[model samples]
Target: MSTPARKRRGRRAYIAGALAEEQVARYYELRGLQLAHRRWRGSRGEIDLVLRDGDAVVFVEVKSAPTHARAAESLRPAQVRRIMMTAQEFLGREPRGELTEMRLDVALVDGQGVIEIVENALSDF
Candidate 1:
């Protein structure tokens, strides 16, 4: 049976998500953070992009929205909880040892080519 048009649109949406992630990763790298991983997964959840700065590992969440408001709203409380859980898992698996100095950062990509970055957007859970 042929897949419906809706399913095809969903697949396209997923691909766009990947492209936005790459853009955000590059944006962070340009700002001097070392790129560690993208779409990094742990048992708890997935971190969109993770970067290292000296001794600190920063867990990043990237939101790509057709509108600025939509992008900012993507960081709902429940979503933050999942990212926090994933960060804990990442720390436990880190070979570098010290994970106490880590923080969470957020990147929002508006379809109009505007990018908003927030560091320490949310307090550790």
Candidate 2:
């Protein structure tokens, strides 16, 4: 059980995360990427954003923190693994899965609510 203050903080965090996702989605949309899904969930975990980038499918993991570095650092290996698994599940259900190129991206949201998208961010991982 959580105290009232803790509960409030948790709710605040959830709201912040959701808003961050929306901002990131809009940022991608402005770049000509069409949003395929938001908060797509599977048995493994949830993908923050799924977008169609031309002939490629992009899976974006959004992180929000006090700073851009902190936001980027928040994506841990375990979380990446979970996101990857969920992405695989998402692709499996798509009819054009094999035909489309896949990409993993990260969107970092800073304290000022600025979004910085890093494409192929997980490629070397």
Candidate 3:
């Protein structure tokens, strides 16, 4: 069951997330990376953004919160696993398949719309 307040909150969150993703995508695009996909979903989970830097693939997860640190902390371990699984599924479609060079990044957006990108944030996971 969903209440009106809950629904409103959910809608607000969705809008915020969309805006955050857009900001992150632009950030990468300005860096010369071409946008490959936005909100790309696989059987495992959804990847917020996917970009191509020459021959390498970059998977980005966007998080928004009142502060950059809070946004960064929002990514849970379980989510990391799901993102990894989804990234693998995404790679399966590439011509190089599993051999395709890729990296997972986390983009954090604060309420003030400040952006901070952490490259290879999921490599250890």
Top candidate on lDDT is 3
- Candidate 1 per-residue lDDT, tens place, 24-121, comes to 88888898989998899988789999998877899989888898689888788988999998998888877864445798988888887677888898
Total clashing residue pairs per candidate? 0, 0, 0
Please provide, for model 2 over 15-110, each residue's C-alpha lDDT reduced to its tens digit, 9 standing for 90 to 100: 999999999999999989999999999999999999998878999999999999999988999998898889888888888864558999999999
- Model 3 Cα displacement at 29 (Å)? 0.5
Q: Model 3, range 1-125, lDDT digits (tens) per residue? A: 56998999999999999999999999999999999999999999999999999999999999999999999889999999999999999999999998999999999999999999899999877
> Residue 32 deviation, candidate 2, in Å?
0.9
Worst 10 residues of 1 by lDDT: 92-101
- Which residue pairs overlap in candidate 2's backbone? none
In model 3, what is the error at residue 24, expressed in angstroms? 0.6
Deviation in angstroms for 68 in model 1? 1.9
- Clashes counted in candidate 3 amount to 0
Off by over 4 Å in 2: none
> Among these predicted structures, which one has the highest TM-score?
3
Ranking by TM-score: 3, 2, 1
Worst 10 residues of 2 by lDDT: 91-100
Worst 10 residues of 3 by lDDT: 1-10
Please give the distance, in angstroms, between residue 1's alpha carbon in candidate 3 and its true position after superposition: 11
